[model samples]
Target: MHGKTSLIEHNGEGVFQGLNNPLTVTRYHSLVIDPPTLPSEFNVTARSASGEIMGIRHREWDLEGVQFHPESILSEQGHQLLANFLKR
Candidate 1:
């Protein structure tokens, strides 16, 4: 999954809390063709400017995922995001 860039806007209340900026750029490939219906145990933590789901977490499980590649150079604050995940 690699191509254009997307804006990941943090919801500011989950794993992404305390981020220096509310939005960051990241490389994205896959598109959420359908609106997701996440399980009740999961909480959405971020989204694209167009409202696509970009990040999610399960608080109880200490699990999380993002549609964009945080390791990619295109991601602003990618290191911080990874650090936050690691600190959790």
Candidate 2:
């Protein structure tokens, strides 16, 4: 990640269901990279403004992951994001 803030667009499925789309989050990473390969069982649930994969979920497995720092106070809806995940 390059900026202090990042835009994350949700796919409105899985763990991200009913939450705000295009969420603005605090990013403080030195390097941004994509996964080499994604398994068929996983679904992309979110992406950055630049089309970088930002979130993924395996509904059947009840698994989810996010690339941004949702725990940071700077994130607009970090608390909500965490809540959603816990509810899953």
Best by lDDT: 2
Residue lDDT tens for model 2, 2-88: 558888899877656776787888888845545567777877888888888888887588888887888898887788778888887
Residue pairs with backbone atoms closer than 3 Å in model 1 (clashes): none
Q: Over all chains combined, what TM-score does candidate 2 have?
A: 0.81
**TM-score for each of the candidates:** 0.79, 0.81
Off by over 4 Å in 1: none
Candidate 1 lDDT by residue in tens digits, 4-87: 777667777555767745566666577662445687787777888888888888869878887787777877777877888888
Instruction: Name model 2 segments beyond 4 Å from true.
Output: 30-36
Lowest summed lDDT over 10 consecutive residues: which window, candidate 1? Answer: 27-36
lDDT of each: 0.73, 0.78
